[model samples]
Target: MNETISNSPHQWNTQELPVVVIAGYGPSIGESTARQFGSKGYAIACLGRTQNKLLDSVQELKASKITAAAFVTDCGDTRSVKEAIQQVQSHLGRISVIVWNAASYVGSDLVTGNDDPSEILNQIVGVGCAGLLASIQEAYEDLKAMKGTILITGGGLSGYDQNVNQIAVNNSWMGLAFCKSSQRKLAGLLHARLKPDGVMVGTVIISGAVRVGGGLDVTDPDDVATAFWEIHHSRHKQEVHLGSLTQLASEPT
Candidate 1:
């Protein structure tokens, strides 16, 4: 964790404060997630590619007088992720909650007759699983030291085949598998190696499109955010599957 604060309105000086680092802060889920945590009195570190959008979210959080910082980060890049984590550690002290919401879709396909699977797989794995690994690795020590929670955003695309045209259908399948596998591994590692130190690893699986007010079919970013918060604050500390999971498998006991 770095301790150098920049000349930004979002920067706040604090010691031993719990912070929430939102990766892939965007107009929809990212923004909503940041605000959700902000409303909960957690300092926010918004990491994404769009500087202006990140700044806007920071300003929105600041309007409520919440501590927030907009960090330009490319999750796919390890160096960028490391620097972003350092910035959060520096500005907010320590991150208590980490939300892995960064995602990329190359295309969707049935995997039966896909012309090029490499590109799509690379993108999905790069942003979904690999990027997640980088972020987790960078923050592992901090979270472990503070006994924090790592929550990854996911959809019910685990077993369904709705998007047969785009390669994401196949690639996301791999991504989900990788994510679940990684979660299991991280949980095991945390329990064996870091539990004594007090850190927990988990995932929040979102199954369907989030519904908003007026019966309008809006994505429930807030619901997802709430799920993340629940996972962080819950006593059980298990993998949470939100919305619907008729086809998804239950966690092994």
Candidate 2:
């Protein structure tokens, strides 16, 4: 199960280093997020389905002299997620932060009837919402034992109205409701139910498509990474939203 190259350096030289597990390690956000956390002395465990891409991300993070390991993981599968978390714990010692950023979209217009609406909704809920549940469940005990932070990455629709097509296909209304409910429930359970044990659960609602130079501009991967870092460092847990497309003007192309 060790897909990472042996030459990889999997050790950080910091006394109080934070261990972070990023489930959806995409080239854009994953890499940027890892680098940002690494710069702050956090050992990163980059997990994704693509082995090559995961390795590349690990190498890039290692270039900064940060401890990093790449593991092939499928978030939709609970067994796979559980195994990945175990591997991360073995390599990084203890996971202090868990970021669930995995999502799936088939690009079908719910209004046009281009594809099976039920299937698309199932995939989104399964991967976007259910996958997150699996990740958190698998790592919850460890986070609680270590007093870690669980930060879930969300979309604009999770908090606001936009993208009519996405709304229909992903059932944004129901999906967001589920997300909010889960966040509050998780926070209550962790903070209230597990207060004696000491664990924090939080969510970061990322509004708008994350892009450079755009109105209601998407948040920068680095900024999002910083937010994750902050969540990990802070003792309290809370939900926070990024930018608004309606408030900010688009950058001149």
| Candidate 2 lDDT, 24-108, residue by residue in tens | 8887667777887778778888888888787777777777887887778887667778888877776667777888777664433
Candidate 1: tens digits of C-alpha lDDT, residues 1-253: 2222235744774634578888877766776777777777888888888766777777777888777877888876767788888887766777787888876644433255555667656665677667667777788887877778777766555434444112223244445544444444554454456556676666666654555431232346677777677777883565666665432332221
lDDT of each: 0.65, 0.66
lDDT of 1 at 109: 39
Cα shift from native, residue 98, model 1 (Å): 1.0
Off by over 4 Å in 1: 1-6, 110-116, 160-197, 214-219, 245-253
